[model samples]
Target: MAHFNKAFQFKTRSIIVLLTVFGFQLTAQNWDVPADKKAKNSYIKFDKTTASEGEGIYTKNCASCHGNPSKGNVLKSLKPTPPDLASSGTQKLTDGELFYILNTGRGLMPSFKDVLSESDRWKVIAYVRSFNKSYVQVLSNTDPTKSDKVKVTMVYNHETNTVRVQVVAKEQNTSLPLKDAEVLLFAKRYFGKLPIEKGLKTDESGVANFVYPKDLPGNKLGEVELLVKVNDEVYGEVESSTKLKIGIPTDKPGLTQQRAIWGVLAKAPYWIIALYLLGIATFGVFVLYLVKNLFDFWKKGQQ
Candidate 1:
């Protein structure tokens, strides 16, 4: 019947409008990449070493306020709850977009441009990605707990010509004394290519003693430079000079010896010697002139 057809048409039209509105809403909402796409390129090739470094950076610079992202310590009162980085929200964002946010900052978050290098920011991005279960699963597949440790420090002694250098292995809050660990020491000329001596281990107090030979050539009477290495893993360097002087007696000689040498050299008066030489020259010249005049007179008389 005509009425039935009208109802059917209305229903169909209503359904079509609803479908169109839903499509628009879905398009407006930003969704993450499809599961199939993620599966195809699940692994984001990044430097594992760099991510490990970013872990430390996160601990030092970001841990104070953010705590651990895994623990959900997000600041909710802020405009938008720090987007759950572990959730699809982060995955939906492209790497470049995420990088921009991290470098430029958003809301209360400070810009990391001045704080982190470009490579470092990428490392951090990799670390943030790791929060996602998919990425976490990938990381675990590679090796869940790979060792990622590094050391950065230099130590040495100048006076004793000894040194102990090693990488420090303590968190920012912790303090490690040089006495607690064993330090290694290596010896060589400051700028020498080859190491003059092999490596030596440190004592309980992390001290390494280096005694230079008294008769070592080139160093006997001048400054000796030595390169110190600790644990065979770090370099501790110091420039030390030997205390040796030749022809210079340690004890002062008696004044008599000095005066005797001076007396001998001063015995002949310089003024008297000069006057005697002048008188001899004058007498010789006078005798020569008289002989010449007598010879001239004899020649004239003979003529």
Candidate 2:
């Protein structure tokens, strides 16, 4: 009976340890994608042409670490090695889930949201989907053409330091508000769009509000380019870019404006430029001396 008790205790401890490890892993890998993003469907149809175009794009962008689909040649050096796109693990993910993963990269993976165009990103997914034989795509019911009729307007308030966005779709002479839509606000940066805040849902009146950061720098005129993107069940997706004079005016000089070692050729420090030229002249003189000596040695040998 004592031996039986010991054995049962050991098994129970083992189960607890396994469960703890699994729970930790789940927490670590959790992406926390919103329900709407996970449910987003591709507006573009997945076809042979798209898949082909995606293949070229994938080869240029994704093939570095993910390797060719189904080849099983993923870059193993990475901590969490990239998975084979053709594998069951990748194939099982929903299209929206995959899209969200691509947009919000984790750990070693970098976000491709800014790097790839919306159409190109979907095409890359199409190429990835081509590897799975049993895969069937469910296209989005939202019409792409209807997105053109959607209008997005932004109003900034000085007192609240918030931007109010209104999204409406025009159907002939009627303008209907788009409520309960997914709205994301971004500030245009040199490289990519910087998200102002977490995505917000429109209210009953088809309005979403975002709190603008007070310290964000802008051009000399205190103008900042604000980009608003809206995704609705009815209107599909709409994007609007607007310039607002709300940012803190920053007239900071460019990095290369003054003379420095790292500055452009024309803007390099005079002392550093002189030293570089001196080094080049010294090398040239040394080469000439060596050649003259060699020539002298050859003349002596000939005599």
Candidate 3:
């Protein structure tokens, strides 16, 4: 009886631990996307050509973690093993859901929203869907050509230290305001674009306002290039760039202006240049002296 009771207790503990771990895994994998994002569809059609292009893109960007589709060679070292794209579980997810996951990554997954264009992201989805033989794509009703009709203008407010972005779509003879659209503003920098603030949604009047930083540095002329990206369900994605004279005027000296070891030869320190030339001259003189000595020794041998 004692042995039976001990075995029962051990089994209970084991079951409880397994349940706890399984519950945690379920919670981690649950990506609760909004209703709008879940319903969003791709403007690009899924075809063989686009799927082939997407395969190349996936090999470069996603294969490192997810591995090739249908292959069980995923990197299992990760805490939550990435699912194979060809697996039934992955194929069950809606196209919009897959897009949302790519845009808003969790844990070890990095967001590709900034890295890949909207067209490219859709192409990647097309490639993944290719693995599902029975999968049928539902194209978005949004007209991608309307993206060219979109116009975005940004204006800075001096007193409030804010930038106002207005979006409008022109069709026929009427200009319609684009309301409730997603807008992202960025400032161009030497290395990469810097986000001005958190992404904002346009209001009823098709305007989104962002607070600009007062301490942000600009060129000597205080000119900063601003880029705005607008995403609307009806118009797809549109981007516009403009230069503004709002940042702090910075006139920092160029890196190559001052003498540095990493600088160009012309920008190298005078002492370093002098030393290099002196070393070359000294080597030439030693070679000439050795040649003269050899010549004198030959003359003595002849004598």
Top candidate when judged by lDDT against the true structure: 3
Model 2 ranges off by over 4 Å: 1-31, 48-81, 107-117, 130-134, 141-155, 165-182, 187-195, 201-207, 213-243, 248-262, 269-275, 290-303
Clashing pairs in 2: none
Residue pairs clashing in model 3 are none
Q: Which of 2 and 3 is the better model by lDDT?
A: 3
What global local distance difference test value does model 3 have?
0.91
lDDT of 3 by residue, 277-301 (tens): 9999999999999999999999999
What number of clashing residue pairs does each candidate have, in the order they appear?
5, 0, 0
lDDT for each of the candidates? 0.50, 0.89, 0.91
Q: Using TM-score as the measure, which candidate wins?
A: 2
Sort by lDDT, best first: what order? 3, 2, 1
What is candidate 3's CA lDDT for residue 202?
Answer: 95
TM-scores of the candidates in the order shown: 0.29, 0.61, 0.60
Task: Assess the local accuracy of residue 49 in candidate 2 as a C-alpha lDDT between 0 and 100.
Answer: 97
Q: Write down the RMSD of all candidates, one decimal each.
A: 31.4, 6.5, 7.6
lDDT of 2: 0.89
* Model 1 agreement with the true structure over 1-303: per-residue lDDT tens digits: 999999999999999999998776444333344332233221234556666777788777666556666776765554444555656766667665666666667546678988987557767767766676554323212211211222324333545643334434343675333332223332333244334344444444444554433443333334334333332112222223222221112234433444443344445356665676899999999999999999999999999
